[model samples]
Target: MVLRYVRRHFKPLLGIKGLWTFRHTPLAMYWAKLALKDMLVETVLKDENLPPDVTNAHWIAHVVSYAGYLAKIRYEGYDTNDDSKTHWVHFCKDLYRIGYCADNHLPIVPPLNVIQQKQEWREWIIKRVTGGYTMHALTQQLIAYDNDTQLRKGTEVEVLDKFSISRMRVGYVKEVIGHRVHVRYWDTDADDQDLSNSFWCHEQSDAINVVGWSKTVGHAISAPAGYDPAEIGNSSVIKKNPGVNIQVGMKLEAVDPLKLSAISAATVVKVLKHGYLMVHIDSAGHALTQTYRGVESDANHGNNRFCYHVTSPLIFPCGFCKENNIELQPPIEFKTDNFDWNEYFKATGAKPLPLKDLEKEVIDHGFTEGAKLEAVDVMEPNLICVATVKRVIGRLLRIGFDGWEDNYDQWADATSCDLFPIGWCQLMNYDLQPPHVENQEPGLKPVSPGVKRIKSKSGTASRSKRQSATSSSD
Candidate 1:
């Protein structure tokens, strides 16, 4: 019944009501269409040269055309009084203007009772009969948006300030500029066929890149495929240069398990271990396993974390989560190998080394071979200092220096830097110290694995301590 009523009214308006059908006056309707097109084209071209406000007129004209069409339907149907025609035309015009306010991020103001009364009549006649008109529904939405009083008081400047970073261009340090893109407002004088005031876009010339709080670098920054750091330079400190070991901790600020469709914080975690580096994330005990260098772990280990080749840190807030809604905190500190390392060693019942014996082993493996263990200890402190500085520099440059394959290769092959790591340095080269492998009879015995190992100190230890202290003091 509702659909029938809508179709009954709309059918008449489609050239069946008061006028002769299109068959009788096809030429008249055809010429009217041509004139309308010409008018809009001229307006759009002229708009290109005008100020943003003036340009908005061209956009507004098109909106007005739509509104006017809606008004015409009512006018043609309720020809009973001049008052109805005036009311609809005025209501549609007001609706078009209210939309302008929304596009400019301005608060909408409710229309007067007169406009509301006209809109009510249009809605009852149409939706009750036909399903609903999208344009009519949108107009009603604008009314509701304007009714939010507190939002009306807000300004574009406040929104921009909260979301954008104010920075001066690299070359211009004397005068600071707000690095933001300002959306334009609507123009009222424009024809109904024109666009809205908020259509023009101009990039800021004086400001540097606008660093949105929500923006993040993707993982596409990894070096190209088949990249070999060892091949690029003579970073081989020994016959076999192993890569440095590293552990990572990930901490998510707050997350919801139910809302996969909602906004939340998440972090990526990586870990270092012997035999293979272990990668997994623990956020509030919610774990995600990660893979290292394209290697997969057994299913018994848990879910293998997928690695997206990372050149720059991947920004997860946009793709998987809501923009500007997530904030990541510093990682929860933990030793990656401790839990896994001790378990392997304990299970194997391997002989544990005394601190003195460990020191002697380090001295034997270290450069200036055969040096006294005490002398090696003295040199270890200096090596620790160097590693600390390197980590600090890496962090400052937004570069991860934790012995990733690419990072090590870059450090080893660089030709410009004189202070590059020596072949024996653990920064670019892996430790040569061999682990105690459990020998098993292949025919009948199960294979026993050795314990995971890690470097207690790296070149970045001092720098990390200082950074940790500085952050804590803050």
Candidate 2:
């Protein structure tokens, strides 16, 4: 589904946006051209570095001051002990670099937080002064040139008057693709584009409101469990056994009147959602069976308190007998009679143990003691060990593909591995001549019927009598 959506929408939108970038923006294109020229000149010219003079040194000082300002404020996070709070100092310098400040233009460096640890700040300044020119310097140069050409039409730098040298409309400067600027139009009308449209938001908001109302209505109509079951018919299948809490899908056995204790026949009762299996007893008018209940007491039993938890089942061996050991006989039908309510209660009580606490206990002492201490693990440790060994052996059998054989044993006997194909390749002897022999053509030369070549043990071929005589004569 994701692939289908991307193919239909995202790919085409990106392609169109990418194409429009170079066509629309002039400033973006010029900056790109300037950067490339600078790179070429720097590489070819040996002595391209500007000479160190008084004016040049002053300009370098300003650049260093600005960079230090930026490093202290923009990049690093704030520290209470450090006084590097003035971010605007760097802002004015950045503006100055991009034609906003002219020659002899003294910027009013605003007072801000001071960067602490004199030794560290001094080292940072030294590095900036000595480090070779970077791509950032080239970008700054373009900004400085643009500002000088555009901003200084008539204004002069006065040593006496502290006026704003920061002029020239500085729109947000994005570092577009190293130094080049690329602009593209994003059409809101495009089908593939996901613009912040009011239509989608409005529709989604309405859907959420409807869902909230629906959930409220659903809760109101639902019936509670253990409601009176006398309204429903018959109620004959349910039989009361001492201490047993009758539940859904329970089978009962009928007892013979004369025998008193011997059961005669069996029957099952099916329970419905929030419905009870009503049993008609000999003396009692009606008795309720286990039904769904959602009280706090029923929390461990999946919110079904009246119902006995299914984990502990009351097993009736012969189906009609209450005893564990029973013999199948003629005429008598099978039934479930034994009522083991104690097992259900125990299981239900323990069900609410927290997962983390249970896990901790398991880690400390296994399942027999609550970890994975099954009878198999405790009684047959060697079998478990053998199983682990076989798993390792299987992994080793399927190894060898390429340089990525570091996981050799792990990947070797993977179900996916195959040494050879069936019919052509066998375990002992496989006919692996070539593809040409496998599919022989009419016009093609008949492939030589398999030949068993004898390999020489020593690195030399045995010479025949005639071949030896010819070699000696030569």
TM-score each candidate. 0.16, 0.15
lDDT per prediction? 0.21, 0.20
Write the residue-wise lDDT of candidate 1 on 1-474 in tens digits: 211222233332111111111111112123223212101110121222233333333211211121112223122122334432222122322233213434655432212332344556445433332432223324334333422222111122111111111111111011111111222222122233221111111122111122211122111111223422222122221122133222243322222211111122333344322211122322222233222112223323433232211211122221222223222222223323222323434554422211111111111111121111000001011111111112111111111112121112111101111111111112112121111123522332211133232222211111111111101011
Highest lDDT: which candidate? 1
The 10-residue segment with the lowest total lDDT in model 1: 370-379
Q: Predicted candidate 1: what Cα RMSD to the true structure?
A: 30.4
Q: After superposing candidate 2, which stretches have Cα over 4 Å from the reference?
A: 1-22, 30-112, 119-123, 132-474
